[model samples]
Target: MNGPTRRGDLFDDVDGARRFTGPTTGDERRMLIDVLRAQRSTLRLKCSGLGPELSLRSAEPSALSLLGLVRHLADVERRWFRQVLAGQDAPPLFSSTTDPDGDFDGATDDPQVVAAAWEAWRTEVAFAEQFVTGAPGLDIEGEDSWRGTVSLRWVLIHMIEEYARHNGHADLLRERIDGAIGL
Candidate 1:
């Protein structure tokens, strides 16, 4: 991987943190999915080009750094998609039944931790995307036990919203780490 940038200059490389500039077709569902994927890519970009120490650094007492956000999102995908969407009773990806924040807590500078996080998140994403593709259609009126009878459309919208919210958190955390912004 590329070496990290200097302090207060984390986003020095424009080519590295490029946002989603792909063509637009004006479909709401597709657009929303694309936006979420772009945000996901942006999160990855923020972590990239950084040294392990800097990537794992915790500027505040709370574990709300970019690394933590990555881990959290990975777990969220597994929980919402693999468990909820697929109607599986399995436990969360990283979080235990008793410890809800296990994913964030387990985040570390260890390569194994990072690799596992990526794999879990990517796999969940793939599963979620596949589910979306195979979906007969969005039924915003449908409800479920977990989501309180939400429609498929609602779930997709909620996922996008969740990602956007976390991406905002990621933006701040990334900025704090190296002063990169508005990628």
Candidate 2:
């Protein structure tokens, strides 16, 4: 409890809370996107100030590390925005024949890899944000093979959930790496 608990950490500030003001015709598009953005920001905040060692250190069997989280998120963002939504045929950002979770597992004690993970994560996040902002009209009736008929709003919300879940894992990993804690 040195700083803010990462569990309930979501929004950075309430200044633009009005983004979700009024009804969205029952669509929580802006709200959901804002929520996702907040979670991503929280992830960045948690990873801030750490050097290559702590950032990439995996304290357990799982590839759950700060650097890994960054890489995974970048891959996720790129997949959703560039591939699925934009209908591109791009390959995965991380994971290859040599190593599965390369983004996470491949983060050596090297400064280059750590820096690349952070940069890729930021770039992908920006791209994803722009894509969502320019998203087509909300369509809850639409269908996906995996999610099935969910709105872009729902997709955004789920992405928030995904990031939040992994961020929760990251919180614990980071805490173990060092005594540092907070949103």
RMSD of each candidate?
5.3, 5.3
Steric clash pairs (candidate 2): 142-149, 143-149
Model 1 residue 148 CA deviation (Å) reads: 0.9
Off by over 4 Å in 1: 1-18, 22-25, 54-58, 140-146
Model 1, 1-183: lDDT tens digits are 899655555455565444576548876677766776777777677677664543454555676666667777777776666666667775677777698777777777887877777777788788878877777777534435566766667777777788778778777776766677766
Clashes of 1: 3
Candidate 2 lDDT over residue span 1-183, tens digit each: 487555444434443344334444544676676678678777776676678644556555666678888888888787666766666775667876577678777766688888888788888888877877787655523444476456666667678889889878877776676655555
Candidate that would win on lDDT: 2
lDDT of 1: 0.69
The true-versus-predicted C-alpha distance at residue 124 of model 2, in Å, is 0.9
Q: Which window of ten consecutive residues has the lowest lDDT sum in model 2?
A: 15-24
